[model samples]
Target chain A: MTTEPRLVEVRKNVLKQNDIIARALRDRFREAGVLAVSFVSSPGSGKTAFLEKTLTLLHSRYRVAALVGDLATENDAARLGRSQVPVKQILTGTVCHLDAAMVQNALDGWDLTQLDFLFIENVGNLVCPSSYDLGEDLRFVLLSVTEGEDKPLKYPTIFNSADVAVITKSDLAAAVEFDEAAVLRNIQAVRPGMEVLKISAKTGEGLAEYLEYLERRCSSSRAGAAASN
Target chain B: MHELSIAMSIVEMAQEESERCGQAQVLAVHLRLGQLSGVVKEALLSSYEMACEATPLEGSQLLIEEVPVEVFCPKCDGPRALGSIQWFCCPECGTPTPEVLHGKELEVVALEIEE
Candidate 1:
C-alpha cells in the first residue's frame, strides 16, 4: 500500500497578528490619553463629509488628527486636511481594508500625547472593515438615507460590530422618502438598543450632539487613565 | 475583494509551514470558515488558486469546512444551532440571541502535507 500524506496540525488564526497589534495600539492610546475613533461605511455614505465637519468643529476645542485609508488615492486626506487638522493618508493598494499595522505605520512620526482625538476613516466598505479592528475606542458605522432602510438587517455583522449607527444625509430624508422609523427598527433588531444618530453634515444639524458625545468619551477616557495611574 | 488578501495570507502560511517541515510539499490546507466570518468560501477558493501560483503551495487544494452560526440561548439555557440564515434567535424559545457561541471562526486547523 502507498504511503498516505502526512497530516500536520497547525491551529492558527489568520488574523491573530492583526489582533495583537491592535491590542498594543489600544493600550498605547490609553496610556497616551488620546481617544481614537474609526468610521466604516459603504461608498457614497458621506463619511468623508461627516468627518470634515467633525474635524472643523472639534479642532477649535481639542487637538485632533486624522488618518484616512483608501485603495488608491489621497483624495480623502486632501479633503479632510482643509479642516487644518494634521491629516495623513494610508494607501492600501489593492487591499480592501485597513489593518492595525497600517494604522501603526501611519502614526510613525506623530506623538499620540499631543492629540486629544485621532480619527481613522476606513475605506468605504461595510463587510471587510468589520473584521479588522484598527484599535479605535469608538467605531461608527454610517448609513445614508439614500441607501435602503434594510441595510442594517442585510449587513448585521457590521452593525453588530459597530458601537453606534449614524444616519447620514438627513437633510434629504424627506426628499428621498427615506423610512426613518423602519431603519431605526432594523438597526435595533440587528443590535438591540444600539445608539442611532441622525445628522446632515452639510446642514450641520445634530453635530452638536455628536461633538458632545465625543467630548464626553474623551474626557471620561482621560479621567479613567488618570485614575488608573 | 479582501478574499484575495486572505487567500494570499493562507498561501503564505502554508509555504511557511512547508518550510518548517523540511520543505515538504503541501498537498492541501484545511480551514475552518464560520458563517459569521464574513468570508465567502467560493471567492476564497478561487483566490487561493490564484494566490498559490509561483508559490510553494502551488497546486495545493484549499479544503474549507463551513461552520454554521450557533448562539448561547439564555432562555433555553443551552446552545442552539441556527436552522436558517435569516434570523439569529433561539430556536427552542424564540428569543433574540445576540451572544454568538460559534460561527465567527477563521482558522487554519491542519494541513495535508506530502509524505
Candidate 2:
C-alpha cells in the first residue's frame, strides 16, 4: 500500500512529563506551606557542605528534611544525616540530573505539612540540572571562589535558570585572590538583578544572615503566610 | 549529557503521536530549539538517532529550528533579539532587558507521519 507521509501539527513540550509531575509537587508544597529549595551547582562547589551547615543550624528552630541526589553513592546522604534531621539519598545511577518524578517518589510517606523546609540537592552538574525543575520555590545556584569569576559566563544558562547565586567557599577568597567584583559583574551580565549572597559554611560566616533571608523570603511567598492571614 | 534523555523524550512523544494517528509511522519530528533552552543542538541531533533505534520511530529524522534569545526590552517597550546569551540587553538601545520573551523553547511543533 503506497501512502504519502502527512504533516501533523503536534506542539508539545519535550519535558512535559517532568513538568506535569513538578507542577503537582509544587501544588502539594503550596498547600502544605513548605518552602522547597533546590540547589544546583557544578561538582566540588560546596553544595553538600553548605547544605550540611544549613540543616544543622536550622534543625533546632524549624523542621527540615533533605533529599540528596548523587550518581551512585549514598555518601552525601550519610554526611547530611549527621544533622539528625530526616535525610534520603536518591541514587540516579547513570542519570546526570534529578527529575521531578524522582523527587516526587523520594518524598513519598513524608508529610509535607510537618516540615518547614525541604531541600533538594541535585546532582553536581551545571548543564543538565538547569533543564529539570523539581517543584522548588527557590533554586540557588552556587559559585565557589576557587572556580573563578568567568564561571557565570561559561555557564550562563544555569545562572539564568536559578533564582539566586550563592558565592561559596568565601573563606578562601583572600588566599585565592578571588575577584568578587568581577564575579558579581559576570553574574549580573548573565542574569540581571538576580539576588546574590556570599557565605562560608566552614567559618559559619554569613550563615545567620542566609538563614534569616531564607525564612523572610519564605514567609513573604504566597504559600508561606497566606494561610495565617 | 542530558541530551540523550531529551532525545528519548522526543522519540517517546513521536511514538505516541504516531499511535494516535492510526498506527502511522513517524518520518520526522520538527522541533523548535532555542539557544537559551540549555540544550545543545548538536548533541541532541546525535542522540536522536540512538533514541529512535529499537523503537517504532526508528530512522526518523529530527528537524530542528534554532530560536535565538529574545528579551523584552523595558526601555524600548518591545521585543529584541539578544546578541549574546551572556548579555541580556536590547541589541539596539543597549538597555538591560532582563525580561525574556522567548528563546527558551524546547517544543515539538510538528511531525511528518505516514498513515
Winning model by lDDT? 2
lDDT of 2 by residue, A1-229 (tens): 8688889999999999999999999989888888999999999999999999999999999999999999999999999999999999999999999999999999999999999899999999999998888999999999999998999999999999999999999999999999999999999999999999999999987888899989987777744457654
* Model 1 CA deviation exceeding 4 Å by range: B83-86
Docking class of 2: high
| DockQ scores of all models, one per candidate | 0.63, 0.86
- In Å, residue B32's CA in model 2 sits off its true spot by 0.7
TM-score of each: 0.94, 0.97
Which DockQ value does candidate 1 get?
Answer: 0.63
The 10-residue segment of model 2 chain B with minimum total lDDT is B95-104
Task: Give a tens-digit lDDT track for model 1, residues A74-96.
Answer: 99988888999999999999888
Give the Cα lDDT of each candidate: 0.90, 0.93
Question: What's the distance in Å from true for residue B61, model 1?
Answer: 1.1
TM-score of 2: 0.97
